[model samples]
Target chain A: MSDEKITPLIMPKWGLSMKEGKLSDWLIEEGTNIAVGDEIMEVETDKIANVVEAADPGLLRRRVATAGETYPVRALLGVLASEDISDADVDAFIEAFEMPVIEDDDDAEAAPLYEFAETSVGRLRYAVRGNEGPVVLLIHGFGGDLDNWLFNIDALATSAKVYALDLPGHGQSTKQLAGADLSGLATAVLAFMDTVGVESAHLVGHSVGGGVAATMAFDAPDRVLSLSLISSAGLGREINSQYIDGFVNSVSRRELKPVLINLFADSKLVSRSLIDDLLKYKRIDGVQGALESLSAALFADGEQKTILTEKISSLDVKTLVVWGAVDEIIPASHAQSLENADVQVIQGAGHMVQMEQASQVNDLIKEHIAG
Target chain B: MARTLSFKDAVNEAIDQEMTRDPTVIMMGEDIVGGTGSPGEADAWGGVLGVTKGLYAKHGDRLMDTPLSESAYIGAAIGAATCGLRPIAELMFLDFLGVCFDQMYNQAAKFRYMFGGKAETPVTIRAMVGGGFRAAAQHSQMLTPIITHVPGLKVVCPSNAYDAKGLLIQSIRDNDPVIFCEHKNLYAHEVDVPEESYAIPFGEANIAREGTDATIVAYGLMVHRATEAAENLAKDGIDCEVIDLRTLSPIDMDTVYESVESTGRLICVDEANPRCSIASDVTASVTQEIFSSLKAAPQLVTAPHTPVPFSPVLEDLYIPSAEQVADAVRKTMAT
Candidate 1:
């Protein structure tokens, strides 16, 4: 009868604006033995569609939420318990479970979803979570904002102070760029850390953000505790220039949707809202020029301009290189470039590996930083 | 950087930003700077509804108050546009197009074509259109069909605040004369609009809501009606895709065709009177281009062939309602 024995699977909040999601399908059947990180159900949000990975391992007792019906954030979708728990006890538990009441006033005061930081790079928009422990900065890739870590930030914040920021010319940050190359972006990140009063911390970067993180570690090794690069740039010379160019040129939703499909292994994950959000960002006055300049400076002629494998391998900083096995943007083979770092090539994911396999990525990062 | 802005504020901000960016941009209209020569505040009524309320203070001499003559002022604006000046002439009500018809259709619209590409009229005429404020038949009329019928002029009617701002900026920067129709009822309606100036390209139809059961095409304030109808239809297990044709002339028929191809049903909603209205134009185009794609005959939900009523109750019923649009959708579903 201990409450700790029952693990309730609640609907997850994927992003800042995601209030509810439809339980599209249940991947696992009732009474199945669940393991950590096992795909249990598929949830479809307006922004994207992703599978819900098990956070707690237990025997699946009951499926409470119906498939194809939407449930609010933190609504109990299912229950998992040990074999000792009876059917009546499980039924009673399901009947008694109450949905968490969302208090708008209290939640606003407790945790603001996003914040603004006035760094040397100009006004930068960022999201901060966790109150204690070592700081972890999450830098998104080109044309991406802080929300790229929507699935990973809260999970990592459980153990470490996590901050995800929009790089210049991305997200809600100032569209003006300090510089377009890796060194320029790296300098902006350092300025952000300095402004936020973070002396040294772990740096987690995705795509071009990975290049910026590496550049930071190379330029100022003492400032970086560790580095986690997921499907990152600057590892090899070959990249999907088509995606880079396509992202820079596409203006309309029809034109941009196909370009975004290349970013995921499951193209279905690129929902309508995702394309609409990107279009809204792209339509901002300076965003197009900023993205075009960055594309030319970083990936001109479809080749990576900055290669840091030799330099990163020489550094003594702890590094974890993770890549989606079927990453189309940057080949998963690039994960092998950093011989000194821990490399993990995840299967069934594309360029957006951190989002496609969020729990696994979060686990790897936690263990890497803690080690 | 995106914040909620009323359609009125969005239009004001677009003109303000464009004026700040280019010194040549000027605004001239009756009462745009209300109390121009009076003993009271100079920039008094910044347009009839204050859409241009504070512009006079910022760009003092640039915003001019003209005589009540629409023909004289519109002609002057067109002339100024051809001579390197970008002028946004406000025609208080679109129904007044009858008074300034020759200047708009003959002069500005044909300048580029008649001059064999030598002349370019980068003038924007901003006017309030549609009937929901009980402004009677004259003050409130959707005369978009008249201006859109002209070959050289670009016609834009935005549905929400975001599109209002972007399309207005585009209209100002465009090389051709653009008749920017601002719906009177949508002035108070708010949506997220970026503070920074951005131009939405012409001929791009925004799919406001995505669905599969049927396709509902609308423009201006009727877009809200169509979306409402779609939501109501959803309760009956019907899904409707609503497309907002942001611009009329050089309209985005491709987006409409794409939606109808999948949904196999079409409903065109326009606040204007039925004959030669945007609804009829869209229905005719859909029938001509992709007739086989439609599983059912296209429906046009529009005002009856009469002037907008002056009475409150009659006016409310005269304009196409969400219920009427839902009824049309139901008919399509039945087919």
Candidate 2:
């Protein structure tokens, strides 16, 4: 027989935390042509559901995994190669495929890499990924934290130092507000910047985080090289008071799911686990008071209170404000409210445009940082 | 005249006072401050109910307003608790708990026990509970039992502003995760609340009224209902003892057992719905421990096994009344 070849299509790991995933559906038949990045199948993790793109371009020789089956990380799902690839070769390749187990051991290596540093403001917990580049401080809006950029941070950090943080009252940082206004948040961000030893870098903020970024840039133009605002809060008067009220007032799953759904253009992005996560946070003590103070400070009567139109206009730092066209938390029209800012209203995303349309936001952030 | 504040204001004062007293104590929640970057004002409603009003001015960013995301913030509060920041996260409404219960049960509640007592989740989750605001079904639920069942978490449902302030302060300082249930209906209900910060320890039942014939145990707003029933019961020449199980999770079983031993009759008045409720839990525990001492079978005055109704009439009939509590007490007394 002529030389035979085989390719291993192992179960892929999409994120740092994913250990196992369920094969949601198979797009290709048992034997079919597949290419790299091809829509081969769908996979569902506990957190999200996404298409599993093909790793190697070739004919899908065998389907070892079936729909609705659960597999550990790196488990061989199938084989892929040219038509000349023999089944015997595929079987041998499968046998050689190393199924790496996600060690259930709780002895976390390297101290979990996440730590909280206490400062004058509150406990600012941050996660720094990648060794080197211009640091990108990811600030989430009103009730958000470092994890809101779960999809974008790692992708953005490939070329730049990515720092995802929990604001004063937002995440593992501290629930206490140093001040309820943008300056309070801005100061905390600066203190966090100082604690982390980043002299100057990019400020990437979403929603209310947009306001914090603007404050940082306005506070010290020398320190902030670039500003990336995604569905920010500072440039407009119209705000979704109902969503804010619903978010603040909601305590049950039924109440929070709807409010959270209002955050994304794709309401389906708000999953059960997502709602469960929010409930877990809200149930913690002091969070209610901190959120109430923030809401009253940032948005009252469901309208934006801190308008920094002129403050951000004259800044020499490269400014990029991205908004989802369907953004509801802070209207997409607010993107136009900035006169001198480079505003891009992404067509499909909502308030969390960075998450919904991450590639564009990441590209915009990268390009703005380069400038 | 009794010096009083709205339930919202009283809660705000409790937080402000506690934060003032203890620098380690901190507050976090969504939109506790009204205006962030808008044109008009700052500290705009002081929360949806305006409970956290003026805290931003007093404590600065220490009174934080988070993004509308509860998981990140609440988990952060629990996280901060382990790191020495006594975080009090406002859940807004108890109904919204579905969004962040994991932080409460799996994380905060389990942290101390899971870590083998090395950690203390000194976190207080303040959430508006019960129905009366026309908040409909989702916004209105007295699901205290759901939290009370979880060990390692201290649950407090104060009936009045006095207990609200004191118990909230206690929740802040307590070295455990506490789910503080705030009855939206009782926020405006006034009572004399001391300005000084003091903590009422958990597992200590407050004897609202002392009597001889029957013992009525209740909590949250139902304490008032029990008091009112005790008043009517007094008129009927049937003196009743009322005990508020101040801390439901650490529940003063000793007080219940003692009362049962003294009176030989028990009636549990709970605002929560019947079915595996605190009432049922208390009834079952009481019967098991104090069955020999009981002269009569225990009675439970609670909401029906159904969702909190929206109609005024249905809601009015939904919650256990003072009359019903007294009647339950009277029945136990007769038996």
Candidate 3:
């Protein structure tokens, strides 16, 4: 992987709709040791403010991508090279680096991110990734969808199959939820897995999805190989009343943005695009009432109505729990409540611990799956 | 399961079955679930006349009982359709659309073309239409022609329970926003509705009764009246073809033209007022497309250009009757 003496720093793609971004700032100067995965520069898209990390290692060389200058995705931003490589070599590499014709949107028109499979539960919408190893199903919390795993899917897909599904009444899946609750959601997930022919899968969940995953593990231990709960709801009694209330009541962007911001450590990540994305989801025909009644049913009294933490010990599955220190929605203290599970506390993260510090959380997930 | 269901029950079964069949489908309306906050029964009244009964209990919150605010909820449902949910929001009665029609005409109907094909508002706004129950102008009045004028919105006014069930289910599942006008008087009418969910696409007209002399085009409750007129004409020597224009927006003019071309005559029967009614629209379309095919001037059988009267006798005469339809068909046959 390190054969390239001249490293190409390309414009990074964040969320689904991002077409281009501005080279906002350069965090490092030339001649610095540009290690792999180091924060090389600061790129800004309309969606969020995130530090662009290096994908390869070399010495920082020519800075073709200037500060505050905008470029389309994969446009050559800068270059890095070894100390032994001469400046002439860097110039040749920069001149030769033609922006590769990145096949993105046009290519995707024929194949979409959303797919509907005729399941026993009806046509369910789900996103699948990876091709090898035991499948891992990433079930989002209340009012969440497959897009919630946009940050985690690429990292986890390297070792195993990763599936992000929209439970009935959520995402592109059908909204006709006649029998809706934790069990109903679990039934849909199990039916989807069976339809997709997954004998066993590691269940990775957030919030309410955590309850569904736990229920599945308790009900059918044979089908679940492992469990990863991030800011899960099943372990504790207390639930944030404001998050629940805001999610149910808020309909407009002005009303919903603050509520969505509560999920992250850095509220700035709650960009207009993020708010717009969530509002788009909430505006979907049946989502509001679905989330409302589901909240009342699952979190009836501002507390975890179904405490299945005790059931986790009975199931013979490798379980890992993680939490964000600054989490406002679900208390980080719940991370220690898993009696026989490995626990990690991510600093400066909120209820959405995985997204706030994706690299660290992804490392922990990979380690658990590798073990 | 396949028992003869009332028209109200047929509508419920359509929504219920479609919701069960497609997870993207959802329903919303005021009092569609009667008791939201009241201490009475949970689903006190499944719609004003009980068309949506038993769905709330089975579907839970997916069957939403909106606030008296139709504009906000209708707009929200329209907005939601663009995101992903195929929402079916009941407007209670056709009269209530006045409080919340801007969302239908400006937002839901125009989202796709306005967004340059980036959006799709697959919403279904269902409301009880047509006059007959002594429920005066406000509660009655077949307003199908009004919605039919819009380009993006698909307007469907089914005459009988079978068409009602299939067309309604299709409306809920269709990828375009739809306006479903149900005749209030037909609620008690009975028909055998299939348990399985299916769709009846727009632009397809149903031949209620076939004849060779003249073609009578109609919709909603009036389709039944047209058939009754055709039956009476059958008793006589006249053979009349009754064409039910189930969907108004994508008007099945081809069916009308084909029948008109064969019969060489046309008589349109509509419950709406005579001025700019479905009858008038059909006549205009026919004249423009197949003026040469016509043997005689098209006769429109519809109520006079006036509001629905309060008196039972006046109201009875106000609706296009079987005798009037027969007379209109006779006029076309004579020429």
Q: Per-residue alpha-carbon lDDT of model 1 for B1-335, expressed as tens digits?
A: 77789999999999999999999999999989965565588888998888999999999999999999999999999999999999999998999998898999998899888888999999999999999898998898888888888899999999999999999999999999999999989999998898888889899899999999999999999999999999888878899999999999879999999999999999999988888988899999999999999999999999998898999999999999999999999998887
* Candidate 3 Cα misplacement greater than 4 A, ranges: A1-3, A15-19, A44-47, A69-72, A102-111, B1-335
* lDDT, candidate 1, A1-371, per-residue tens: 66798889999988666778899999999989999878999999888899998989999999999997889899999999999998888888888889875445336566777788999889988989898888999999999998889899988999999999999999998998999899989999999999999999899999999999999999999999999999999999999999989899988878888899999999999988888889888888899999999999999999998899999989999999999999999999999998889999999999999999888899999999999
Q: Which residue window of length 10 is worst by lDDT in model 1 chain A?
A: A101-110
Ranking by TM-score: 1, 3, 2
Q: What is the lDDT of residue B11 in candidate 1?
A: 97
lDDT of 2 by residue, A185-289 (tens): 989988888887888878888888889999989988888888888888788899989999999888655467778888888777786557655654664557788
User: Looking at model 3 chain B, which ten-residue stretch has the lowest summed lDDT?
Assistant: B192-201
Q: Give the DockQ (C-alpha) for candidate 3.
A: 0.02
Interface RMSD (Å) of model 3? 15.9
On the 0 to 100 scale, the lDDT of residue B207 in model 2 is: 69
Tell me the deviation in Å of residue A97 in model 1.
3.3
**Judged by lDDT, which candidate is best?**
1
TM-score of chain A of each: 0.96, 0.87, 0.92
TM-score of decoy 2: 0.53
lDDT of 2 at A146: 74
Candidate 3: lDDT over CA atoms? 0.81
TM-score of 3: 0.54
lDDT of 1: 0.92
